[model samples]
Target: MKIALLQMTSGIDPDVNAATLETAIADAAGQGAAMLFTPEMSGLLDSNGARAATQVTDEVHDRVLARVRAAAAREGVWVHLGSLAVEGDEGDPRWANRAFVIDADGEIAARYDKVHLFDVDLPTGESWRESSRYVPGQDTALVNTPVGKLGLSICYDMRFPALFQALSGAGATILSVPAAFTVPTGQAHWHTLLRARAIENACWLVAAAQTGTHEDGRSTYGHSLVVDPWGKVVLDMETTAGLAVCEIDPAAVDDVRSRVPVIAHRRAIPVPA
Candidate 1:
């Protein structure tokens, strides 16, 4: 299947982001891309937590999501919208970091809420407390799509290997890691971590990233990558905001797994004395 990874620098405005997404979706589809993947917080990216909270809305009420769905239907292409910061359903005012898979018919096929929250103080003097603003999700999602079985995850989830292993075990051949990585962390760990996940899990790793600086005065690392099951970097968008399209062959997963067979090599460990 042909896939397009959309590297973007989204701002706090949902309307402008939606318009951008629609155009990319159309362009990708016109180029015969079967699916389009976007970065996390593609709908809204603002440095101020309070402003983001107020600007982002629930999934049903989010015009950004609605617009993407419409574009998906019109273009007849599958859309992995990466993730959207949305209001929590549990009466808590904090929003949820959620990723969605919309089918060509514009129906939401799968939804994965990001489990891991980023809360850290970087040496670059950048600090974030995501838990204070967004409620964490507890489940993992692997969706069946035309391209292949998709493993769903947002930005921070890339740091956790266990999640990718579990998704691969659950029959996911293509792992989607849509991210908005901070400059410091991205520069240090982005490629290495993504390659590790792909090699260890024996699955295709596709990460569409948020690039450049946003209206929030925050800059993100922009190196969107498409890794093969064998951990080879097939396509890389280096600090550019554009579409990176590549073909994904499902057979490659099986071929790599047969050669390495790490999953089958795993053994359950008993509690040690």
Candidate 2:
């Protein structure tokens, strides 16, 4: 299957970001891609909590999501809209970093909130407190797409192997990990972690990333990648903010799994006393 990954330097303006996504959807479809994957924070990327709150709204009221859905239907393509920062339920004061899987008919197939919040103080003097503003999701999401059964996750979730293990065990042939990673961490562990996940789980790993400096004065290490089941890097859009397309063979998953047989041999680990 042919898939497109959008590497974006999302800005603070939701409207602008929405337009960018709309165009990318059409472009991807025109290029014969069955699906398009976008980066995290695709709608708005503002570091200023006060300013970003002005644009944040409930999922039903998000203009960017609405536009993207319409575009997806018009183009007749599936879209894995990475992650959008939106308002949470009533009286919750916090927001959600949510990812949506939109079908070709513009209907939402599944929604997955980012389960792992990035709450780390990096060595580069950069700090993040994702839990401070967004609530963590409770469950994992797996959905069928044009490519295959896709497992959903966001930026910080990449660090957790258990999440990928669950997805693979549940018959997921593809994993979608959309991210807006910091430059420091991305440089250190992005490629290594992604390859490891694919190798261990024996699934295709597709990661769409946010690249370049953003309007909010933050920079991301963008290396949107597509790793095959054998942990081969088939496509890599390094540090470029644009759209890139690549072909993925699902049969490779079967080939790798048959050779390794790791998933079948997986045994439950016991807790140490």
Candidate 3:
């Protein structure tokens, strides 16, 4: 299957972001992409938690999501919209860092919210407290696509290997980690961790990511990559807001699994007492 990954430097405006994304998706479809994936904060990158909390609305009322659904139907391709901040509650008004998969008919096939909150102080003196604005999801989601079973995750979730292992155990051949990683962390850990996950799970890895600078002067690492089952980077969009297209054959998954059989080689046992 031909898949396209979209990397964008999103800002705080929803309307402009949607228009830009539509153009990108159209370009990918024109190139014969059967499926298109966008990066995290595909709609808007609202840096101010307080302001974003007041602006973002419920998923049912989100104009951004509606536009994506319409675009998917119009293009006749599946769209994996990276992540959007949707309303969660009344008082706290949490954000759901969510990813949506829209089928060719524009119907939502699956929705996965980010389970892990990005609450940490970077060595660069940059602090991110995602929990203050977003309510973390409680479940791991794996969606069956025409290509294969795909595991969904966002940003910080990439750091946790156990999640990918679980997704692989649940029959996922492709793992998607849509991220807006900080420059510090991305430069240090991005390629290493992504490749490690692909090699360990013996699954294809696709990570569409935020690039350049946002409205808040925050720079994100933008090397969006697609790794094959054997942990080879088939396509790399390094630090530029563009699309990376590649073909991922499901048969390759079986080929690699049979060769290594790493999943079956494991003997489950308790940790050291």
Residue lDDT tens for model 1, 1-273: 799999999998989999999999999999999999999999999878777767887888999999999999999999999989888977797889999999999999999999999999999888899998888998999999888899999999999988998999889999999999999999899999999999999999999999998999999999999999999999999998988789989899999989999888877778899
The Cα RMSD in angstroms, rounded to one decimal, for candidate 3 relative to the true structure is: 1.3
Which candidate should be chosen as best, given lDDT against the real structure?
A: 2
Per-residue accuracy of model 3 over 1-273 as CA lDDT, tens digit each: 889999999988898889877887788788888888899989889788666655588889888898988888898888889999987756766778999988888899999999999999988899999898789998898998766799999989998988999999889999999999999999899999999999989999999999998886899999999998899999889998877788988888999999998787766779998
How accurate locally is residue 138 in candidate 3, as Cα lDDT from 0 to 100?
88
Q: What are the per-residue Cα lDDT tens digits for candidate 2 across 157-258?
A: 999999999999999999999999999999999999999999999999999999999998999999999999999999999998999999999999999999
What RMSD, rounded to one decimal, does every model reach? 1.0, 0.6, 1.3
- Count residue pairs with overlapping backbones in model 3: 0
**Between 2 and 3, whose TM-score is larger?**
2
Off by over 4 Å in 1: 271-273
Q: Output the lDDT of residue 27, model 3.
A: 81
Question: Lowest summed-lDDT stretch of 10 residues in model 3?
Answer: 46-55
lDDT of 3 at 256: 97
Instruction: For candidate 1, list the clashing residue pairs, or say none.
Output: none
Report the error of model 2 at residue 123, Å: 1.2
